[model samples]
Target: MIKIETPLTIDKVKCLKAGDEVLITGTMYTLRDAGHMRVIEQINKDEKLPFDMKNSIIYYVGPSPAKLGAVIGSAGPTTSYRMDEFTPALLELGLKGMIGKGARNKEVIQSMVKNTAVYFGAVGGAAALLASCIKSSEIIAYEDLGPEALRKLYVEDFPVIVVIDSLGKNIYEIEKEKYKIVE
Candidate 1:
Protein backbone atom coordinates (compact mmCIF):
# COMPACT_ATOMS: atom_id res chain seq x y z
CA MET A 1 0.00 0.00 0.00
CA ILE A 2 1.21 3.51 -0.78
CA LYS A 3 1.58 5.85 2.21
CA ILE A 4 0.57 9.50 1.91
CA GLU A 5 0.15 12.56 4.12
CA THR A 6 -1.59 15.92 4.06
CA PRO A 7 -1.65 18.64 3.09
CA LEU A 8 -1.12 16.88 -0.21
CA THR A 9 1.08 18.61 -2.74
CA ILE A 10 0.49 18.76 -6.46
CA ASP A 11 3.42 16.45 -7.15
CA LYS A 12 2.16 13.88 -4.63
CA VAL A 13 -1.35 14.00 -6.06
CA LYS A 14 -0.12 13.61 -9.63
CA CYS A 15 1.94 10.56 -8.68
CA LEU A 16 -1.08 8.59 -7.43
CA LYS A 17 -3.19 6.38 -9.72
CA ALA A 18 -6.65 4.87 -9.51
CA GLY A 19 -6.87 1.48 -7.73
CA ASP A 20 -3.84 2.12 -5.52
CA GLU A 21 -4.32 1.31 -1.86
CA VAL A 22 -3.20 4.16 0.34
CA LEU A 23 -2.64 4.79 4.03
CA ILE A 24 -3.18 8.47 4.63
CA THR A 25 -1.61 10.26 7.55
CA GLY A 26 -1.62 13.76 9.03
CA THR A 27 -4.55 16.20 9.03
CA MET A 28 -7.90 16.21 7.27
CA TYR A 29 -11.33 17.73 7.74
CA THR A 30 -14.72 16.10 8.16
CA LEU A 31 -17.78 17.61 6.53
CA ARG A 32 -21.07 16.30 5.22
CA ASP A 33 -23.64 18.04 3.01
CA ALA A 34 -24.74 20.69 5.51
CA GLY A 35 -21.19 21.70 6.31
CA HIS A 36 -20.38 21.80 2.61
CA MET A 37 -23.30 24.10 1.96
CA ARG A 38 -22.24 26.47 4.71
CA VAL A 39 -18.70 26.62 3.34
CA ILE A 40 -19.90 27.40 -0.16
CA GLU A 41 -22.22 30.06 1.19
CA GLN A 42 -19.32 31.63 3.05
CA ILE A 43 -17.25 31.57 -0.11
CA ASN A 44 -20.04 33.26 -2.01
CA LYS A 45 -20.25 35.98 0.65
CA ASP A 46 -16.46 36.48 0.44
CA GLU A 47 -16.19 35.58 4.15
CA LYS A 48 -13.15 33.75 5.44
CA LEU A 49 -13.49 30.04 5.96
CA PRO A 50 -12.84 28.47 9.37
CA PHE A 51 -10.01 26.42 7.91
CA ASP A 52 -7.52 26.83 5.13
CA MET A 53 -8.48 25.23 1.84
CA LYS A 54 -5.08 24.96 0.16
CA ASN A 55 -3.90 21.41 -0.34
CA SER A 56 -6.44 20.19 2.19
CA ILE A 57 -8.40 16.94 2.26
CA ILE A 58 -12.04 16.77 3.27
CA TYR A 59 -13.66 13.52 4.28
CA TYR A 60 -17.37 13.24 3.67
CA VAL A 61 -18.50 12.00 7.07
CA GLY A 62 -20.80 12.73 9.93
CA PRO A 63 -19.20 10.84 12.78
CA SER A 64 -21.28 9.28 15.53
CA PRO A 65 -20.93 10.41 19.13
CA ALA A 66 -17.74 9.12 20.65
CA LYS A 67 -17.83 6.11 22.89
CA LEU A 68 -16.16 6.26 26.28
CA GLY A 69 -12.43 7.04 25.93
CA ALA A 70 -12.49 7.19 22.10
CA VAL A 71 -11.51 10.08 19.87
CA ILE A 72 -14.39 9.46 17.50
CA GLY A 73 -17.06 6.82 16.99
CA SER A 74 -18.19 4.90 13.95
CA ALA A 75 -16.74 7.45 11.58
CA GLY A 76 -17.76 5.94 8.29
CA PRO A 77 -17.63 7.70 4.97
CA THR A 78 -20.88 9.17 3.68
CA THR A 79 -21.89 8.86 0.04
CA SER A 80 -19.84 11.49 -1.80
CA TYR A 81 -22.15 12.43 -4.66
CA ARG A 82 -24.35 14.27 -2.16
CA MET A 83 -21.73 16.98 -2.10
CA ASP A 84 -20.97 16.95 -5.83
CA GLU A 85 -22.64 20.27 -6.52
CA PHE A 86 -20.16 22.08 -4.26
CA THR A 87 -17.08 20.00 -5.06
CA PRO A 88 -15.76 21.91 -8.04
CA ALA A 89 -15.79 25.19 -6.15
CA LEU A 90 -13.84 23.65 -3.29
CA LEU A 91 -11.35 22.13 -5.76
CA GLU A 92 -10.97 25.53 -7.34
CA LEU A 93 -10.13 26.85 -3.88
CA GLY A 94 -7.13 24.45 -3.84
CA LEU A 95 -8.61 21.54 -1.96
CA LYS A 96 -6.35 18.66 -2.95
CA GLY A 97 -8.03 15.48 -1.83
CA MET A 98 -11.40 13.99 -0.83
CA ILE A 99 -12.29 10.77 1.01
CA GLY A 100 -15.64 9.06 0.69
CA LYS A 101 -17.50 6.29 -1.13
CA GLY A 102 -18.81 5.97 -4.73
CA ALA A 103 -18.31 7.83 -8.00
CA ARG A 104 -18.17 11.55 -8.52
CA ASN A 105 -20.07 13.38 -11.25
CA LYS A 106 -18.55 14.58 -14.54
CA GLU A 107 -18.15 18.20 -13.47
CA VAL A 108 -16.41 17.19 -10.26
CA ILE A 109 -14.05 14.89 -12.19
CA GLN A 110 -13.23 17.67 -14.62
CA SER A 111 -12.60 20.03 -11.73
CA MET A 112 -10.34 17.51 -10.03
CA VAL A 113 -8.30 17.10 -13.22
CA LYS A 114 -8.06 20.83 -13.64
CA ASN A 115 -7.16 21.35 -9.98
CA THR A 116 -4.66 18.50 -9.62
CA ALA A 117 -6.68 16.70 -6.98
CA VAL A 118 -7.65 13.12 -6.05
CA TYR A 119 -10.59 11.22 -4.58
CA PHE A 120 -10.23 8.41 -2.08
CA GLY A 121 -12.72 5.64 -1.41
CA ALA A 122 -13.21 4.44 2.14
CA VAL A 123 -15.01 1.19 2.85
CA GLY A 124 -18.65 1.92 3.57
CA GLY A 125 -19.32 -0.65 6.28
CA ALA A 126 -16.02 -0.23 8.13
CA ALA A 127 -16.93 2.65 10.38
CA ALA A 128 -15.59 1.29 13.65
CA LEU A 129 -12.33 0.19 12.08
CA LEU A 130 -11.94 3.59 10.41
CA ALA A 131 -12.48 5.45 13.67
CA SER A 132 -9.46 3.73 15.15
CA CYS A 133 -7.29 5.51 12.60
CA ILE A 134 -8.30 8.89 13.87
CA LYS A 135 -5.78 10.03 16.48
CA SER A 136 -7.70 13.14 17.46
CA SER A 137 -10.81 15.07 16.54
CA GLU A 138 -12.18 18.51 17.31
CA ILE A 139 -15.17 20.44 16.12
CA ILE A 140 -13.78 23.29 14.06
CA ALA A 141 -16.98 24.90 12.88
CA TYR A 142 -20.76 24.65 12.61
CA GLU A 143 -21.14 23.12 16.04
CA ASP A 144 -24.85 23.80 15.94
CA LEU A 145 -25.07 21.24 13.19
CA GLY A 146 -24.08 18.57 15.75
CA PRO A 147 -22.89 15.44 13.98
CA GLU A 148 -22.81 17.30 10.69
CA ALA A 149 -20.39 19.88 12.07
CA LEU A 150 -17.00 20.41 10.45
CA ARG A 151 -14.22 18.73 12.34
CA LYS A 152 -10.45 18.81 12.21
CA LEU A 153 -9.05 15.33 12.42
CA TYR A 154 -5.52 14.20 12.99
CA VAL A 155 -5.26 10.73 11.50
CA GLU A 156 -2.49 8.20 11.23
CA ASP A 157 -2.35 5.56 8.54
CA PHE A 158 -6.02 5.94 7.72
CA PRO A 159 -6.88 3.39 5.06
CA VAL A 160 -8.33 4.39 1.69
CA ILE A 161 -8.04 3.66 -2.03
CA VAL A 162 -7.44 6.05 -4.84
CA VAL A 163 -10.84 5.86 -6.50
CA ILE A 164 -10.15 8.82 -8.78
CA ASP A 165 -6.69 10.15 -9.44
CA SER A 166 -5.64 13.62 -10.44
CA LEU A 167 -5.53 12.75 -14.12
CA GLY A 168 -9.19 11.61 -13.88
CA LYS A 169 -8.47 7.89 -14.13
CA ASN A 170 -11.30 6.23 -12.18
CA ILE A 171 -11.08 2.92 -10.36
CA TYR A 172 -14.83 2.41 -10.68
CA GLU A 173 -14.66 2.59 -14.47
CA ILE A 174 -11.54 0.45 -14.67
CA GLU A 175 -12.95 -2.21 -12.36
CA LYS A 176 -16.27 -2.22 -14.20
CA GLU A 177 -14.51 -2.97 -17.44
CA LYS A 178 -12.23 -5.53 -15.83
CA TYR A 179 -15.09 -7.50 -14.27
CA LYS A 180 -17.74 -7.09 -16.98
CA ILE A 181 -19.34 -10.30 -18.24
CA VAL A 182 -19.05 -10.75 -21.97
CA GLU A 183 -22.43 -10.76 -23.68
Candidate 2:
Protein backbone atom coordinates (compact mmCIF):
# COMPACT_ATOMS: atom_id res chain seq x y z
CA MET A 1 0.00 0.00 0.00
CA ILE A 2 2.75 2.39 -0.91
CA LYS A 3 2.08 5.60 -2.83
CA ILE A 4 4.54 7.41 -5.05
CA GLU A 5 3.88 11.09 -5.74
CA THR A 6 5.02 11.85 -9.20
CA PRO A 7 6.70 14.27 -11.52
CA LEU A 8 9.09 11.36 -11.15
CA THR A 9 12.68 11.23 -12.30
CA ILE A 10 14.83 8.18 -12.89
CA ASP A 11 16.44 8.47 -9.48
CA LYS A 12 13.11 8.70 -7.68
CA VAL A 13 11.67 6.05 -9.95
CA LYS A 14 14.48 3.56 -9.28
CA CYS A 15 13.59 3.66 -5.63
CA LEU A 16 10.05 2.48 -6.26
CA LYS A 17 9.14 -0.99 -5.00
CA ALA A 18 6.54 -3.40 -6.23
CA GLY A 19 3.01 -2.78 -4.85
CA ASP A 20 3.50 0.99 -5.04
CA GLU A 21 0.74 2.99 -6.67
CA VAL A 22 1.91 6.06 -8.48
CA LEU A 23 0.16 9.30 -9.38
CA ILE A 24 1.99 10.66 -12.37
CA THR A 25 2.06 14.34 -13.26
CA GLY A 26 4.04 16.36 -15.81
CA THR A 27 4.17 14.94 -19.33
CA MET A 28 4.07 11.53 -21.02
CA TYR A 29 4.37 10.38 -24.59
CA THR A 30 2.07 7.91 -26.32
CA LEU A 31 3.56 5.42 -28.74
CA ARG A 32 2.16 2.13 -29.88
CA ASP A 33 3.32 -0.52 -32.39
CA ALA A 34 3.91 1.66 -35.42
CA GLY A 35 5.58 4.35 -33.39
CA HIS A 36 7.82 1.81 -31.68
CA MET A 37 8.95 0.40 -35.01
CA ARG A 38 10.01 3.79 -36.28
CA VAL A 39 11.89 4.56 -33.09
CA ILE A 40 13.76 1.31 -33.28
CA GLU A 41 14.80 2.05 -36.85
CA GLN A 42 16.15 5.37 -35.69
CA ILE A 43 18.01 3.71 -32.85
CA ASN A 44 19.63 1.11 -35.14
CA LYS A 45 20.90 3.83 -37.40
CA ASP A 46 22.29 5.74 -34.43
CA GLU A 47 19.95 8.61 -35.19
CA LYS A 48 18.66 10.97 -32.55
CA LEU A 49 15.34 10.26 -30.87
CA PRO A 50 12.37 12.63 -31.19
CA PHE A 51 12.28 13.57 -27.52
CA ASP A 52 14.43 13.59 -24.43
CA MET A 53 14.38 10.07 -23.03
CA LYS A 54 15.80 10.88 -19.63
CA ASN A 55 13.29 10.26 -16.85
CA SER A 56 10.39 10.19 -19.30
CA ILE A 57 7.48 7.75 -19.38
CA ILE A 58 6.21 6.19 -22.59
CA TYR A 59 2.60 5.05 -22.65
CA TYR A 60 1.77 2.09 -24.91
CA VAL A 61 -1.48 3.31 -26.36
CA GLY A 62 -3.37 3.78 -29.58
CA PRO A 63 -6.30 5.84 -28.54
CA SER A 64 -9.83 5.89 -29.95
CA PRO A 65 -10.51 8.65 -32.42
CA ALA A 66 -11.24 12.06 -31.07
CA LYS A 67 -14.84 13.13 -30.83
CA LEU A 68 -16.09 16.57 -31.73
CA GLY A 69 -15.01 19.31 -29.25
CA ALA A 70 -12.86 16.89 -27.35
CA VAL A 71 -9.14 16.97 -26.55
CA ILE A 72 -8.95 13.27 -27.21
CA GLY A 73 -11.40 10.42 -27.60
CA SER A 74 -11.63 7.34 -25.37
CA ALA A 75 -7.98 6.71 -24.52
CA GLY A 76 -6.49 3.78 -22.69
CA PRO A 77 -3.50 1.53 -22.46
CA THR A 78 -2.84 -1.07 -25.10
CA THR A 79 -1.11 -4.41 -24.46
CA SER A 80 2.50 -3.76 -23.50
CA TYR A 81 4.26 -7.02 -24.40
CA ARG A 82 4.16 -6.13 -28.09
CA MET A 83 6.63 -3.36 -27.46
CA ASP A 84 9.26 -5.68 -25.92
CA GLU A 85 11.41 -5.82 -29.04
CA PHE A 86 11.80 -2.06 -29.18
CA THR A 87 11.93 -1.41 -25.45
CA PRO A 88 15.42 -2.57 -24.61
CA ALA A 89 16.92 -0.21 -27.15
CA LEU A 90 14.79 2.63 -25.85
CA LEU A 91 15.84 1.74 -22.31
CA GLU A 92 19.48 1.96 -23.36
CA LEU A 93 18.64 5.47 -24.49
CA GLY A 94 17.63 6.31 -20.90
CA LEU A 95 13.93 5.66 -21.16
CA LYS A 96 12.94 4.95 -17.58
CA GLY A 97 9.22 4.40 -17.32
CA MET A 98 6.43 2.68 -19.28
CA ILE A 99 2.65 2.59 -18.78
CA GLY A 100 0.39 -0.06 -20.16
CA LYS A 101 -1.42 -3.29 -19.27
CA GLY A 102 -0.17 -6.90 -19.02
CA ALA A 103 3.29 -8.32 -18.56
CA ARG A 104 6.52 -7.70 -20.38
CA ASN A 105 9.20 -10.24 -21.38
CA LYS A 106 12.19 -11.60 -19.50
CA GLU A 107 14.51 -9.44 -21.59
CA VAL A 108 12.51 -6.34 -20.79
CA ILE A 109 12.66 -7.01 -17.07
CA GLN A 110 16.37 -7.73 -17.21
CA SER A 111 16.95 -4.52 -19.09
CA MET A 112 14.94 -2.61 -16.51
CA VAL A 113 17.12 -4.01 -13.75
CA LYS A 114 20.31 -3.23 -15.60
CA ASN A 115 19.19 0.28 -16.50
CA THR A 116 17.25 1.15 -13.36
CA ALA A 117 13.92 1.56 -15.11
CA VAL A 118 10.30 1.02 -14.04
CA TYR A 119 7.15 -0.27 -15.66
CA PHE A 120 3.71 0.96 -14.59
CA GLY A 121 0.32 -0.49 -15.43
CA ALA A 122 -2.70 1.66 -16.09
CA VAL A 123 -6.15 0.26 -15.62
CA GLY A 124 -7.59 -1.67 -18.55
CA GLY A 125 -11.01 -1.00 -20.17
CA ALA A 126 -11.10 2.51 -18.77
CA ALA A 127 -10.78 4.45 -21.96
CA ALA A 128 -13.11 7.32 -21.14
CA LEU A 129 -11.80 7.45 -17.59
CA LEU A 130 -8.18 7.61 -18.80
CA ALA A 131 -8.93 10.40 -21.26
CA SER A 132 -9.94 12.73 -18.48
CA CYS A 133 -6.44 12.84 -17.09
CA ILE A 134 -4.84 13.83 -20.37
CA LYS A 135 -4.63 17.60 -20.48
CA SER A 136 -3.56 17.89 -24.11
CA SER A 137 -2.32 15.72 -26.96
CA GLU A 138 -0.33 16.55 -30.06
CA ILE A 139 1.61 14.61 -32.61
CA ILE A 140 5.30 15.09 -32.12
CA ALA A 141 6.45 12.68 -34.80
CA TYR A 142 5.28 10.17 -37.42
CA GLU A 143 2.07 12.02 -38.18
CA ASP A 144 1.29 9.81 -41.18
CA LEU A 145 0.41 6.93 -38.87
CA GLY A 146 -2.95 8.34 -37.69
CA PRO A 147 -3.88 7.10 -34.21
CA GLU A 148 -0.52 5.37 -33.94
CA ALA A 149 1.23 8.69 -34.27
CA LEU A 150 3.86 9.60 -31.70
CA ARG A 151 2.17 11.95 -29.31
CA LYS A 152 3.37 14.14 -26.51
CA LEU A 153 0.65 14.07 -23.92
CA TYR A 154 0.41 16.49 -21.03
CA VAL A 155 -1.13 14.69 -18.11
CA GLU A 156 -1.85 15.42 -14.47
CA ASP A 157 -2.37 12.92 -11.69
CA PHE A 158 -2.44 9.96 -14.04
CA PRO A 159 -2.90 6.79 -12.01
CA VAL A 160 -0.89 3.58 -12.40
CA ILE A 161 0.57 0.66 -10.46
CA VAL A 162 4.25 -0.08 -10.21
CA VAL A 163 4.34 -3.33 -12.11
CA ILE A 164 8.07 -3.95 -12.20
CA ASP A 165 10.75 -2.11 -10.30
CA SER A 166 14.47 -1.56 -10.88
CA LEU A 167 15.25 -4.18 -8.28
CA GLY A 168 13.60 -6.85 -10.48
CA LYS A 169 10.45 -7.12 -8.43
CA ASN A 170 7.23 -7.60 -10.41
CA ILE A 171 3.66 -7.09 -9.28
CA TYR A 172 2.32 -9.11 -12.19
CA GLU A 173 4.29 -12.14 -11.04
CA ILE A 174 3.01 -11.82 -7.48
CA GLU A 175 -0.57 -11.24 -8.59
CA LYS A 176 -0.51 -14.14 -11.01
CA GLU A 177 0.77 -16.51 -8.39
CA LYS A 178 -1.68 -15.19 -5.84
CA TYR A 179 -4.68 -15.68 -8.09
CA LYS A 180 -3.61 -18.83 -9.91
CA ILE A 181 -6.25 -21.51 -9.43
CA VAL A 182 -4.56 -24.78 -8.75
CA GLU A 183 -6.27 -27.49 -10.63
Candidate 3:
Protein backbone atom coordinates (compact mmCIF):
# COMPACT_ATOMS: atom_id res chain seq x y z
CA MET A 1 0.00 0.00 0.00
CA ILE A 2 1.27 3.48 -0.84
CA LYS A 3 1.55 6.02 1.96
CA ILE A 4 0.88 9.62 1.00
CA GLU A 5 1.93 12.77 2.80
CA THR A 6 0.04 16.04 2.88
CA PRO A 7 0.86 18.99 0.68
CA LEU A 8 0.65 16.24 -1.90
CA THR A 9 1.12 17.34 -5.46
CA ILE A 10 -0.68 16.55 -8.69
CA ASP A 11 2.49 14.86 -9.93
CA LYS A 12 2.57 12.60 -6.89
CA VAL A 13 -1.09 11.67 -7.26
CA LYS A 14 -1.25 11.49 -11.05
CA CYS A 15 0.89 8.42 -11.43
CA LEU A 16 -1.45 6.38 -9.25
CA LYS A 17 -3.72 4.04 -11.19
CA ALA A 18 -7.03 2.52 -10.24
CA GLY A 19 -7.00 -0.58 -7.99
CA ASP A 20 -4.03 0.74 -6.02
CA GLU A 21 -4.51 0.65 -2.26
CA VAL A 22 -3.07 3.59 -0.34
CA LEU A 23 -2.56 4.68 3.22
CA ILE A 24 -2.94 8.42 3.60
CA THR A 25 -1.05 10.14 6.38
CA GLY A 26 -0.74 13.75 7.51
CA THR A 27 -3.64 16.23 7.82
CA MET A 28 -6.97 15.85 6.03
CA TYR A 29 -10.07 17.89 6.58
CA THR A 30 -13.59 16.53 6.82
CA LEU A 31 -16.55 18.27 5.21
CA ARG A 32 -19.96 17.41 3.80
CA ASP A 33 -22.91 19.34 2.36
CA ALA A 34 -23.22 22.09 4.96
CA GLY A 35 -19.52 22.68 5.24
CA HIS A 36 -19.14 22.64 1.49
CA MET A 37 -21.83 25.30 1.12
CA ARG A 38 -20.13 27.53 3.63
CA VAL A 39 -16.80 27.14 1.86
CA ILE A 40 -18.38 27.97 -1.48
CA GLU A 41 -20.03 31.03 -0.02
CA GLN A 42 -16.71 32.23 1.29
CA ILE A 43 -15.06 31.60 -2.05
CA ASN A 44 -17.75 33.50 -3.93
CA LYS A 45 -17.29 36.56 -1.75
CA ASP A 46 -13.51 36.51 -2.29
CA GLU A 47 -13.26 36.22 1.46
CA LYS A 48 -10.47 34.33 3.16
CA LEU A 49 -11.04 30.60 3.32
CA PRO A 50 -10.96 28.73 6.60
CA PHE A 51 -8.18 26.38 5.60
CA ASP A 52 -5.55 26.32 2.90
CA MET A 53 -6.72 24.37 -0.13
CA LYS A 54 -3.25 23.97 -1.59
CA ASN A 55 -2.22 20.37 -1.89
CA SER A 56 -4.96 19.28 0.49
CA ILE A 57 -7.36 16.39 0.54
CA ILE A 58 -10.95 16.86 1.62
CA TYR A 59 -12.89 13.94 2.96
CA TYR A 60 -16.66 13.84 2.45
CA VAL A 61 -18.06 12.83 5.79
CA GLY A 62 -20.40 13.74 8.63
CA PRO A 63 -19.51 11.37 11.37
CA SER A 64 -21.63 10.19 14.28
CA PRO A 65 -21.05 11.62 17.74
CA ALA A 66 -18.10 10.25 19.56
CA LYS A 67 -18.65 8.21 22.70
CA LEU A 68 -16.57 8.84 25.80
CA GLY A 69 -12.78 8.40 25.49
CA ALA A 70 -12.97 8.28 21.74
CA VAL A 71 -10.98 10.64 19.49
CA ILE A 72 -13.91 10.90 17.09
CA GLY A 73 -17.31 9.49 16.27
CA SER A 74 -18.08 6.70 13.85
CA ALA A 75 -16.20 8.36 10.98
CA GLY A 76 -17.02 6.92 7.61
CA PRO A 77 -17.18 8.28 4.09
CA THR A 78 -20.50 9.69 2.87
CA THR A 79 -21.86 9.70 -0.66
CA SER A 80 -19.62 11.90 -2.83
CA TYR A 81 -21.93 13.34 -5.44
CA ARG A 82 -23.71 15.67 -3.02
CA MET A 83 -20.58 17.83 -2.82
CA ASP A 84 -20.07 17.91 -6.60
CA GLU A 85 -21.40 21.43 -6.92
CA PHE A 86 -18.62 22.87 -4.78
CA THR A 87 -15.85 20.42 -5.61
CA PRO A 88 -14.77 21.81 -8.96
CA ALA A 89 -14.20 25.26 -7.53
CA LEU A 90 -12.20 23.88 -4.65
CA LEU A 91 -10.16 21.80 -7.06
CA GLU A 92 -9.28 24.95 -8.92
CA LEU A 93 -7.87 26.31 -5.68
CA GLY A 94 -5.35 23.44 -5.55
CA LEU A 95 -7.31 20.80 -3.73
CA LYS A 96 -5.77 17.63 -5.13
CA GLY A 97 -7.67 14.75 -3.61
CA MET A 98 -11.09 13.63 -2.39
CA ILE A 99 -12.28 10.61 -0.47
CA GLY A 100 -15.85 9.42 -0.39
CA LYS A 101 -18.34 6.80 -1.49
CA GLY A 102 -20.28 6.19 -4.73
CA ALA A 103 -19.72 7.61 -8.19
CA ARG A 104 -18.94 11.23 -8.92
CA ASN A 105 -20.58 13.35 -11.62
CA LYS A 106 -19.11 14.00 -15.03
CA GLU A 107 -18.22 17.54 -14.06
CA VAL A 108 -16.28 16.43 -11.03
CA ILE A 109 -14.58 13.69 -13.01
CA GLN A 110 -13.66 16.16 -15.72
CA SER A 111 -12.27 18.56 -13.17
CA MET A 112 -10.21 15.78 -11.63
CA VAL A 113 -8.76 14.77 -14.96
CA LYS A 114 -8.10 18.31 -16.10
CA ASN A 115 -6.45 19.15 -12.82
CA THR A 116 -4.63 15.82 -12.48
CA ALA A 117 -6.35 15.06 -9.17
CA VAL A 118 -7.45 11.71 -7.78
CA TYR A 119 -10.53 10.21 -6.13
CA PHE A 120 -10.63 7.39 -3.64
CA GLY A 121 -13.43 5.27 -2.23
CA ALA A 122 -13.69 4.24 1.36
CA VAL A 123 -16.08 1.48 2.35
CA GLY A 124 -19.54 2.90 3.09
CA GLY A 125 -20.83 0.73 5.94
CA ALA A 126 -17.58 0.41 7.78
CA ALA A 127 -17.64 3.20 10.30
CA ALA A 128 -16.10 1.48 13.25
CA LEU A 129 -13.60 -0.16 11.02
CA LEU A 130 -12.71 3.19 9.49
CA ALA A 131 -12.61 5.03 12.79
CA SER A 132 -9.99 2.63 13.99
CA CYS A 133 -7.59 4.08 11.46
CA ILE A 134 -7.98 7.73 12.45
CA LYS A 135 -5.16 8.55 14.85
CA SER A 136 -6.57 11.84 16.11
CA SER A 137 -9.21 14.47 15.36
CA GLU A 138 -9.62 18.19 16.00
CA ILE A 139 -11.91 20.88 14.72
CA ILE A 140 -10.21 23.31 12.36
CA ALA A 141 -13.16 25.51 11.42
CA TYR A 142 -16.97 25.91 11.35
CA GLU A 143 -17.41 24.29 14.70
CA ASP A 144 -20.95 25.63 14.91
CA LEU A 145 -22.07 23.35 12.13
CA GLY A 146 -21.74 20.29 14.37
CA PRO A 147 -20.36 17.18 12.76
CA GLU A 148 -20.57 18.83 9.38
CA ALA A 149 -18.01 21.31 10.62
CA LEU A 150 -14.56 21.19 9.05
CA ARG A 151 -11.99 19.39 11.14
CA LYS A 152 -8.42 18.22 10.74
CA LEU A 153 -7.93 14.54 11.26
CA TYR A 154 -4.66 12.73 11.75
CA VAL A 155 -4.75 9.42 10.01
CA GLU A 156 -2.30 6.53 10.14
CA ASP A 157 -2.37 3.94 7.47
CA PHE A 158 -5.87 4.99 6.59
CA PRO A 159 -6.78 2.54 3.88
CA VAL A 160 -8.42 3.45 0.58
CA ILE A 161 -8.74 2.09 -2.95
CA VAL A 162 -8.13 4.37 -5.88
CA VAL A 163 -11.48 4.43 -7.70
CA ILE A 164 -10.66 7.08 -10.26
CA ASP A 165 -7.20 7.95 -11.54
CA SER A 166 -5.85 11.17 -12.97
CA LEU A 167 -5.95 9.63 -16.43
CA GLY A 168 -9.76 9.25 -16.07
CA LYS A 169 -9.52 5.52 -15.55
CA ASN A 170 -12.35 4.28 -13.34
CA ILE A 171 -12.41 0.88 -11.70
CA TYR A 172 -16.16 1.02 -11.20
CA GLU A 173 -16.78 1.46 -14.91
CA ILE A 174 -14.71 -1.57 -15.75
CA GLU A 175 -16.20 -3.65 -12.95
CA LYS A 176 -19.74 -2.74 -13.98
CA GLU A 177 -19.13 -3.93 -17.51
CA LYS A 178 -17.48 -7.08 -16.26
CA TYR A 179 -20.49 -7.88 -14.09
CA LYS A 180 -23.09 -7.11 -16.82
CA ILE A 181 -23.54 -10.73 -17.92
CA VAL A 182 -25.01 -10.23 -21.39
CA GLU A 183 -27.26 -12.90 -22.78
Q: Which one is best on TM-score?
A: 1
| Model 3 lDDT per residue over 1-183, tens place | 888877679778976899899988888999999999999999989999988999899999888988899988898899999999889999899999899989988999899888889999999979898899888888888999998999998888888899999888999998899889888
Report lDDT per candidate: 0.95, 0.87, 0.90
Q: Residue pairs in steric clash, candidate 1? A: none
lDDT of 2 by residue, 43-145 (tens): 7898888988877889998888888878898888999999998899888878889999998999999999998999999998898998999989988999999
Model 2 alpha-carbon miss at residue 157, Å: 0.8
Give per-model TM-scores: 0.98, 0.93, 0.96
Span of ten consecutive residues with least summed lDDT in model 1: 3-12
- lDDT value for candidate 1? 0.95
Q: Tens digits of per-residue lDDT for model 1 on 62-105?
A: 99999899899899999999999999999999999999999899
The all-Cα superposition gives candidate 1 an RMSD in Å to the true structure of 0.8
TM-score of 3: 0.96
Residue 178's C-alpha lDDT in candidate 3?
82
The lDDT, on a scale of 0 to 1, for candidate 2 is 0.87
Error of 1 at 14 (Å): 0.8
Q: Scored by Cα lDDT, where does model 3 land?
A: 0.90
